[model samples]
Target: MSNNRQPDWDPRSPAVFDDQIAAYDRMRGRCPVARSDYLHWSVFRHADVLRVLEDHGTFSNVVSRHPSVPNGMDPPEHTAYRALIEPYFAPERVRAFQPVCRGVAADLVGQLPAGGGVELMGGFARDFALRIQCAFMGWPAELHEPLRQWTHRNQEATLSGDRAATAAVALEFDGFVRGLLDARRKAGNAAPDDVTTRLLRERIGDRPLRDEEIVSIVRNWTVGELGTIAASVGILAHYLAAHPDLQRRIREDPSLLPAAIDEILRIHAPLIANRRMTTRAVEIGGRRLEAGARISLIWASANRDEAVFGDPDEFRLDRDSAHNLLYGAGIHVCPGAELARLELRVVMEELLARTRAFALMPDKPPVRATYPAGGFTSLALWVERCS
Candidate 1:
């Protein structure tokens, strides 16, 4: 609930959107907790972000008027839905998904040009996300392009801060999920026993789950899959392309990849920030605020905080990973983190194994993606196929 008080900074300004990580870095040092009209209040420091993460009771996740399924719930209700979805990402499930995940990665990697200029973001990284996510959900290949367009529209609406448009886009997505659910229901016992089908059968209480509830659950999964996975791939690919020697070294010893990917993403986060709302009056970073205060925990800044990492850009495989806020933390920590990590590791392995080398094109620099998306909008890399 920000008011007519002088705002600290503009989050949607050209300066901030140009390079969100650097802008967040500047904010972390200047004002650890600053108020802005766009984001209300943004928590920039690692310590403050950690505090908010640990104290979920004080900083509620019910920040939006629109329901965000489990992500927008607090405690008991969140606890139930959270527990329901946790098994889908269990270690056994992830292990089961690896071969399928690897197949998707390899297919996408094979589509990369041989020793030529290619825009990795457009049809490659983005397509991989769409295809892999659909495959995971037991969705049809036909949904890939539609989902891509849907994701683009969703990001645009969010960036514009258009609640109506965002909700409209959300409804459109719900339609997509509902259509699939209808097909499953019509098929009944013949329906494919996939994640979506299982969700349809799940019960939240004594009553069976409703369509809206299932839609919300699928929405969360799809958004996490389509947006962050695409961004993560582009970021990892760009990082490797920009640092050929490290790329060569990782290629030489593939075992370094899992830790290396985590460290690199810690330095340049694929997901920028997430929202929270205060339930009661609280003082954070020397700033006092009342109830229903809007807060944004900037993961991009917290992970790169100099106090935590000392040298934010110093890539290392040996650093204690407990501090990395890449998948968030606490009760709200992303359920999909393990899947994300496995997906990233598999994709990078395929990308590196398939190419002899990948370097940033001399004349073509990558265009940085804006607010709702991290990584590049377009990344041109000269990729040499393995001989």
Candidate 2:
């Protein structure tokens, strides 16, 4: 890597932000592995992205100088933390949490105006994510608005690429989690037996987890649940609104909801990209890159790569599920995959069951979210309630 070599692309260009998916599709075609001043090297094609994922030794997940728990660590360390976190989303745990999840979904769906227009993002999607996250973590309702604001600030900081602002946001989140831990510690024997309290008791390497480690672990779960879950809700709703036929099919057979949700998300990803740093000199997509180069696995593009998915946008449940990188792949695959799937499926099922039909409002077009975020910013749809 040298300052002399010009940037292959500008990730922040106005054109790219205007419609990220379309731009990434073009990039996958034109420059599968491209470099930018902001992101260094971006691997867009499915095959190339898979290559990076499978060989974690070469493309390391520890991209940030700041700590990111298991996400920012390499093997052995990543393995231990990952093992500790996985049980929280285990099948039985996820199943036990279903009633609470469904209640949250049902309550939000009930709030939708009967047979009327609603802005899905604000009125439904974000609310569902916030409520479900708080309920899962045993957080109070009072924290929702603050957490919502924090999520917005975090996203803004990430998109701005301002390290100071990002750090400030991280500190703000840490304060919130630290307060929860402090209260639980003071309560001691009387503390609510919940996920947050349980984290305080977790042991790593024959010692109780440190406050910072607990904060990082909780922060990771919060970010994944709040951001991706919210984005997925909006994306799924908007997709269904635009495709009435698929909507009807899913409604007719609720069992199809799970596969439908996965297929739709694969077509239009909720997560944009994930970062990896090159551990050593490597060649990808016919490009030479030196060790220590930063890399972005562009999920927004890779999942829809025509090389693997044929038409890319074609909706087909029969497609091989393994090829879909909705929750990613390799060692860093999303630990909360099962939890996410359950949340998406339950919410969509409740929504479809409650509404007769939902379609895009002819007068109000949905706005696409910018980079570091995916899905709609605001989606207006007309709902026809079941009579």
Candidate 3:
């Protein structure tokens, strides 16, 4: 109800969206925990955000009325869905997916233009994410175009803040997943053994998961797996292009890619923020929030908080990993974190191995994505594809 108050900041302003990282950095220093009519309460500090995360009892994840599988659930209810989904990203499963992931990466990097300026985001990064997601889920290539279009609609609806539009796009996605489920069911014994099929037989207590639950889980993964991976690919490539020395070093010794990837993503987070609601009155960062308060945990800011990372721009591998909220912390920490790591590492390794060098196109600067998204939407890079 207090959303009627004066706004602290316009999150969708050109100043913030044009360069999200810089704008967020300023917000962190000026007001670590801010009240915005747009975001309700935006928590910018690392410690403050971590506090909300660790204490889920005080900060609920059910910020929206729409159900979001385990992502929007807490404790007892969340516990069951979380346990059910985590095994999907277990070590064995991730290891098994490595070769498939590598093939997708190599194919994408292989498509880069020869020593010419190419728009990295649409040309390579997004394609890589789309291909990898389909491969990981055992979906057909025909679904790629539809998923791409759906992702765009989802992002637009989310940023527009139109609940009706958001719900409409969500139903469109459910239809896509339901179609896949129906095919697998009709195929019966001939169904291709993949994640979707596996999910069909999964049980919550004594009952098989309903179609709605299955669709919700798949939607959450698509939101997590597809968009973030695409953003991360662009961020990683842009960072490497900007810093040739580090890129050269990574190419020389690919062993450093994992740590380097984490550090780079720490510098520029792919996922902007996550939502939470105050279940009880709590004071955070000199501001008291009443119960039912809507909160936005700005990962884009927290990961780069100067207090934790000491000179957020400096790239160093020696820093403590525990403090990096790149994948977040606490009970609701990303269950698919291992899968993300495996995918990124495989992609980077293949990219470095395939390319001699890549540099930003001086003439065409990168175009930053607006709110509800992170990283560049268009990145022109002069890619020197290796022989």
User: What do the candidate models score in CA lDDT, each in turn?
Assistant: 0.89, 0.91, 0.90
| lDDT tens readout by residue for model 3, 1-387 | 233356778888888877889999999998888888788899999999999999999999987777889899999999999999999998999999998998888888888886888998888888888889899899999999999999888988987899999989999999999999999999998999999999999999999999999999999998778889999999999999999999998898888888898999999989999999999888889888999999999999999998888899999977788898989899899998988999999988988888888899889999988877888889999988887
Error of 2 at 285 (Å): 0.8
- Among these predictions, the greatest lDDT belongs to 2
lDDT of 2 by residue, 129-187 (tens): 99999999999999999998998899889878898999999999999999999999999
Give all TM-scores, in the order shown. Answer: 0.97, 0.97, 0.97
lDDT at residue 172 of model 1 (Cα atoms): 96
Q: What would the per-residue lDDT of candidate 1 be over residues 34-115, giving only the tens digit for each residue?
A: 9988788899899999999999899999987777789999998999999999999999999999999999999888887777
Judge candidate 3 at residue 212 and give its lDDT: 94
Ranked by lDDT, top first: 2, 3, 1
Clashing residue pairs, candidate 2?
none
Where is model 2 more than 4 Å wrong at Cα?
A: 1-4
- Scored by lDDT, model 1 comes in at 0.89
Q: Which portions of model 3 show Cα errors greater than 4 Å?
A: 1-4
